[model samples]
Target: MKICVVGGGLSGLVSALELAGTHQVDLFERKPVPGGCLGSYRIGDYWIEEYYHHCFAGDAALLDLFDALQVADRLVWLRGSTGYYVDGTIHPLTTPTEILRYPHLTLMEKARLGLLTLRSRRFDVQALDGITAKDFILDNLGSGVYSSFFEPLLKSKFGDRAGEVSAAWLISRIAIRSDRGAGGERLGYLKGGFRHFVARLEEEATRRGASIVPDTPVEEIRREGDGWVVDGKSYDAVVSTLPPQVTADLAGLDIARIPYQAPPA
Candidate 1:
């Protein structure tokens, strides 16, 4: 069967790879560069992520993906320290000693904050679904802690929409980054760049007879008779990783409205 996967991000590339050997697969990417947010920038002699990203020690699936692409040797674990800029002062928050030395919050508040960060993963996320992060922080750690610390983090991450963010989402984010060492958090990065992994995935998929088309935006898709019509070409099936609104617009279908927060600029 002929298959077409839309939006040439990691998901699209992986899908095309899985089906490449068994069927005819054609992947489409709208951008000139195909890695999406995982794409890299070459600075002088090195390549780094356009945006910043690091993998945690608990990232089993990500490690598995690296191994599958035969680039496991490039994986490097590095200590990444974190800091907070409060009231024109840079406060390094990596070490427990640093958090203790900070005078913004009382000893009790600091203890409460540490406890909250540690318990983030074990908390019942459903209970926090409807509650705003602002409310959650204020209720659990008091106004002093919220106003002095977490509020700044929320504002930096979500800007004006921080008040609308659910406690569940915020806590889940905290949980994902909980792998901390004495000095800082241990994060995994590829020695060269993640672009090597992307290139390998693309190369393997192509070697298995998949066609990856770049700079092609799938603007139209219609279910006509039995099969699907994709950008004037006929395909037996379709898989799309584009946003709901975008896919809905392309297929001329009415989809249920979902509350989506605009990303930080």
Candidate 2:
């Protein structure tokens, strides 16, 4: 089988690696490099990630991949702090004492927020698909918590579309970071940069017979009788790791709108 994997981010690279041994695979990347969002920049003698990237203790798949690449030993656990800035003051909210000192929420409101955080892991996130994050926070945690706490965080990430973001996204995000201690959440990072991970993935996939085409953005995809045509090349199947709207645009298909926000400047 011949497979066309679009967007040589981690997902596309890993997919090609998984399929290359048994099938002819071609992975396309728009950038000169294959890391996609995980791409890094050269700083004198070192590579630094374009964005701050970290993992959780619960990231099993990522851990397994690190093990497979013989780099699991590079995983480092660190305590990360959280905070809020209001007016001109920076309020650190990592520890219980810090949270208690926050001026915006009442003691009762803080208790309610704590309770919700404790119970967030048990939430049926799928049931929240239809509800907005704004509504979810307002209903369960009260308007004070929503406005004083979560709204700013949401707005920071999603901008004007924050209100339209789903409760499932909010709940699942909370659940994943529920492993917290007095200092902060336990987060993982590679000893060096994640560029090593990307390099290993690309090397292994190519060794297994995958052809990686960098500096190539998929321009067109269309059905041709039984199989598919991607960029005028015939393939038994096409797998796109690009965003849904982008894939829909290239494939010329209609899909329900899914809101996305670009990275903060």
Candidate 3:
């Protein structure tokens, strides 16, 4: 079967790679280059990630993807430090001692924060889908933790739409970062850069007979009888890794709106 994959991000590329072995695949990316959020820039002899990313020991799928791409050996485990900047001060929150020393929330607030971290993984994420992160934090950890601690983070990542973010995403993010050590959280980074991983994925997928079309925004997606027509080309099936709302708009479907935040320019 011929398949059309829209939005050539990591998910689209990976899907293309997986399906290209037995099916004809075409991946469309609006950007000049693929990788999407994992996109990078060439700095002289090296590639630097446009957005910073790191993995925890718990990132089994990511680690597995690295190994599958034969780039696992390039992964270097590092102790990543974190800090909170408030007023004119930069307070380190890398270790337990530092977290305890930070003078933001009260001891009780700190206790609640720690408990939330510990309990984050056990949360029923599906049940949190209807609730906002701000409400969840406010209800469980109080306004101080929400305003002083999590709000800034949400703002930094999500910008103005931070308040609309669901608690499910927040809880899952906290759960992902729960792995810690004596010094700090153990983080994983590719030695050269994640660009190598993205390149390897593209190469493998292409070698397996996938066509990657970059700088091509999918303008149309309409039903063509039993199959689908993307732009002017028809495919046996269509897989969209684009944001749900964007896909819905392209297909001319009237679905409930899902709030989305585009990456910063």
Candidate 4:
């Protein structure tokens, strides 16, 4: 079988490698290099990410993939700090002690907040989908707790749309973090940048008879008979991993309704 994979991001690269064992694979990437968001740029003598990214210990899928690729040794975990700025002051807010010491909430409010965290961890997020985080926090910890602490945090993170965020998202986020082990609470980083992992994937795919073409963007995709043609080139199968707008344009399909939001950083 012959397979054509569009985009050379992490998903596409991994897909090509997984399929190369029994199928001839061709990967196309518009950028000059692979890695997509995982790619980095130079900052003086060091490399810096365009956006902040760190992996939690519970990311077993990523850890397993790295281990299978023989690059697990490159991962390094670090104990980092988290701070909150409230009322024009920066407060250390990492541990339970710090949370208790937080001056923004009263002792009863703090206890209620802690109980809410524990309950959120144990509750099913889907059950809370109909609620908003603001309402849920206010209901559990009171309006004062919401207005004094969580509201500001949400505003700082999500800006004007903070109130629109669903309670399920908040619950899931807290639940996942609360379940992490001591080491899992820490963050992990790949040495030399994530490009190393991307390069390794590309090398493995090519070694397994996959052809990777960079700087080749697919302008069109149309179904013909039982196969697909991408940019006028025929392929037995096409797997598109482009943005929804790009996919619609390539396939010449009507644009579907999509929720619009501020561009993520």
Best by lDDT: 3
User: What C-alpha lDDT does candidate 4 achieve relative to the native structure?
Assistant: 0.80
Query: For residues 1-265, could you state the per-residue lDDT of candidate 1 as single tens digits?
Result: 9999998888898898899999999999987767776777678987787777667888888788888888989988888877888789998887778888888999999999899989998999999999999999989999999888888888888788878889999898888876675777788988788888888889999999999999999989999888899999999999987777778889997986555653221
Q: Rank the candidates by TM-score, best first.
A: 2, 3, 1, 4
Model 1 scores worst on lDDT over the 10 consecutive residues at 256-265
Q: If candidate 1 were superposed on the true structure by all CA atoms, what would the RMSD be?
A: 2.4
Candidate 3 ranges beyond 4 A from true positions: none
TM-score of each: 0.89, 0.95, 0.94, 0.83
How well does candidate 4 score on lDDT at residue 147?
90
Residue 42, candidate 1: how far off, in angstroms?
Answer: 4.4
- Give the clashing pairs for model 1: none
Give the least accurate 10-residue stretch of model 4, judged by summed lDDT: 256-265
The local lDDT score (0 to 100) that residue 77 gets in candidate 1 is: 88
Candidate 1 segments exceeding 4 Å error: 42-48, 259-265
Overall lDDT per candidate, in order of appearance: 0.85, 0.89, 0.91, 0.80
For TM-score, candidate 1 versus 2, the one ahead is 2
| lDDT per residue as tens, model 2, 1-265 | 9999999888998999999999999999988988888878788989899989999987889899999988888788988888888899889988777888999899999999889889999999999999999999899888999999999999988878888999999988988887787777898998778988999999999999999999998999998988899999999999999878988999997966577655532
The per-prediction tally of clashing pairs is: 0, 0, 0, 0
In terms of TM-score, how similar is model 2 to the real structure?
0.95
